[model samples]
Target chain A: MTPGPTPGPLPGPTPGLRIRGLVKSFGGRRVLDEVDLVVERGEVVSLLGPNGAGKTTLVSVVAGLLRPDAGSVSVLGTDVVRAPRAARGRIGLAAQDVAVYPTHTVEENLRFFGALAGLRRGELRTSVDTLLETLDLTPLRRRRARELSGGQQRRLHVGCALVHRPRLILLDEPTAGADPQTRRGLLRQVRALADDGGTVLYTTHYLQEVEELDARVVVLGDGRVREDAGVDQLIARYTRSELVLRFSGEAPELPWPGARVAGDTVFLPTDRPGVDLVKAVELTGQDRERLRAVELSRAGLEAAYLELLGAGRDE
Target chain B: MNRALTVARHDLVWLRRDPAPVITMLLTPALLMFFIKPLYVGALDRLGYRGVNGAELAVPGMTVMFSFFMAGLVTESVFREHGLNTWARLRVSPLRDTELMTGKVAPCLVLVMAQSCVLFLLGRVVMDLRVRGSLLALLAVMAALSACVVAFSFLLCAVARTRRQAFAYERVTTLVWVILGGTLVPTELMADWVGSLAGFTPVYWASHGYREVILDGEGVAGVLPHVGVLCGFTVLFVALAVWRFNGGADKQHWD
Candidate 1:
């Protein structure tokens, strides 16, 4: 595979959001516990976890909508708990639900939220127009928010959050319940945001999004960070290797160490390739001419996520 | 501050879209004043009470009752947004608590004013309730009543957990105020002790103040004590509402 370009440095620390030792609970149930994360300007960090993994709680606390029992959250150098208004102004939150006003048209909703974010008349107009075009929502600009489809409403929610150009963005399942096409479109825009020097903290159950963005993945289980590492490293460490061997004759009964059979192919897991290849040919009683094909591959992120989550644990 | 207004503007849009509720709120007072008033007057006549016509007495009472309904509508709308988690979205924004409080107060005040105007016009044009006072006195009474309604609504919004609860509380409280304060039926029709006790209710003061201005041609001085009492209620309700608002703690859950 060709090597990708190295990423540029993060934006200045002035607008970065940092959290440390965050903890929270509700009705005697611990939701988030001692969580820590940092989203530097211009970087995208995907918080990957299953449902009920406390991802939302963490984001809420960082957004200053919730106060943690014990922790410190600082946004653009201001403590969220101490200076919530200033900290909140620097962050944009696209809620999990489609939280747009149903009574207003798309443009009106955007204009209202934009104005709330401190944009004036001329700037608000330009910003709303630009967001509409970028999200391909201009066609539905005059439509009341309640009249839009679920995906359209979700897109409008994002547009509302982006209207004022907040430095840090917290997206909670931004593409949840969306069709494949709509999900792709939203992901494209989110990636573009990161490319344009914006910091994004994305939480979702879809592992593919983590892979698509090549973002650092933080896996949470039972309100704790299970792993935090690069996607490639994660796949290498958590996934099992698989090998496919095609033979001309019936499948061999030979002890082909650590191998499984599928149709006429023998799937093997072997680190010693040359030794395994020789053994496979001899065990199959095939000459060099009878060898059909051989392939080696590692598992994807989905497999890694399953493995990390201890799939089929009862077994 | 601008952000709060933005929220309020969006709220206004939502309110306009919900035409059914507005229609019901607008019609409630008219029905009470026009249809039920004659029945009340006939009952008083049969009882041999030498007093003013029941319909005329009910006109001012219905006006204050309309103010109560207006308060409940606005408060319920805001509380519904909170229960649906939309308030969480707003709370996380740059909007401060004061801005949000102001935004909430503005629309309810506007709605109360509108309701008062509609009732006043109906009383004047349709019912021919004689206007003895200057228009300025009537205006002052309306303003005071509107302030009380807005403040009471804010108090309800701060405490209500669900939309259903808010609506129930609003309805029950308004009904109790009307029945006890002689808004629905004249206090003179009740026992003498009950009539005296009704004077302490906020609704009683509001209706009494309006009667002084519209029926007696009294200036501000004539209704100063009632105005003062209503103002006290407003201050107390507003302070409690602000104190009870969640300190940005409702948005912590991911699920």
Candidate 2:
């Protein structure tokens, strides 16, 4: 958890990543509008957003690949725009695209990026060896990147970014098109990195990963921060569990209030599934013989994300 | 500078894995030099040099002309990073744009210089070519020409929007310079008006320096002006490249 040499005065113990009044536009279309966010040290923040929701734009701006029209981004107390080199030294960005040199072997790719990050002889070697083992790339270390399969290449791509053991890691959909094993390995590494006091900002369409990482989910939509909370908290606050009753034949009219029917199944949105299940059964006393199954559908991260995004569209 | 060298070392490693392009570039000129020696000898004879064999002009001429294709190798290396989607990764690293460009341009510089030295070695060993001037002066000309080619490649990378466009530009520009600058035919042997345009090409000065040392037996002092002109061209190309190169621009990597 040693901080790299930051070449400026610090404003106390700063967060790993901080953005305020951030704005970015492309061809007059605002992609990010007055956004504000902060990720503390040792925190793993999962950024959730739909396509075209400016998730990649935000990552690009933080990586110093694109200039932001407004606002400020500070990485580990260094302003990204003002001192890009200093900020960049502390950030490791694995872009959404699978980027690696096809001509270079897995080990070469790791070493090259490590050297660029100013890692020297023995330290660079140790980092590369550890990353190869962590990413399950040791056996394939000598294999050129082009020879690896899609999933193997994806793993190597992510491996190249963090080989320098950067302070702040930005993973933009690191698991896209990855196999189940690759995805799991990456998620585990991300969690481990965070647990070791390294900050991580991860973006993914897969909500399960967020829950798996126990990350604080930040749902972004319409160029603004919509929701920021823990996964269970979001589910609890934004969604309701449903008491579902499926009948064998045509669903009879339920006398219970707030009951909705679709295709012989009745749905009752409820905070208390046990009491509602009993009430639903009692209400369908005569039709109870035809009831095929009773189930409670608990809301999860996906439902909460949908509710948040849907609410965004409503406004 | 060390970071740039690291990148350069990375590029050199990749070159070792696939040495076909470098191998072809180095060997292509030797074959051309061997086949065109008689023509060069006749041309040199017509220019009032008695008993002069063709390697004097053919070796350096082909070396300078083919070095443009060597520059193409650098252009390809730059765009290959983009094509492989590695450019963004490099851009995201801590290296500055100049360092990244240096890393890419350094290996190609070595290759271009190697091509020239190898060609001259073959000329000496096989074509009965002798350098009456200082070898140090000849080496300086080669080094300056290599720098100019590398700079010109960066300018091509800066302006071309697509990989195909870069290749097309490289071929057309190289051939145009070859014809106008006296690589294919000495500017003296070309149409009389072509002389006015010959001095504008970096290759023209490169070839002129070679002639001074190899043909006229000029020492280091004799070829200094041509080397200076080549260096000037290098500076101008570098300035234009820096002005036009946009690291953020979305170049069409494949098309």
Error of 2 at A305 (Å): 2.1
| Lowest lDDT block of 10, candidate 1 chain A | A1-10
Docking quality level of the chain pair in candidate 1 = medium
Best by TM-score: 2
Question: What are the runs in model 2 whose C-alpha is more than 4 Å off?
Answer: A1-13, A255-257
Candidate 2 displacement at residue B80 in angstroms: 0.7
lDDT of 1 by residue, B1-255 (tens): 666677677777777788677778778888778876666567557546445466556677788887888876666667656555667767777887778777877887887888888877887787776667767777777888889888888887778766666677888988888888877676767889879889767898887787777656788788888888888888988899888977453422122
Query: What TM value does the first chain of each candidate achieve?
Result: 0.86, 0.92
**Which 10 successive residues of model 2 chain A have the least lDDT summed?**
A1-10
Clash numbers, per candidate: 1, 0
C-alpha DockQ of every model: 0.65, 0.82
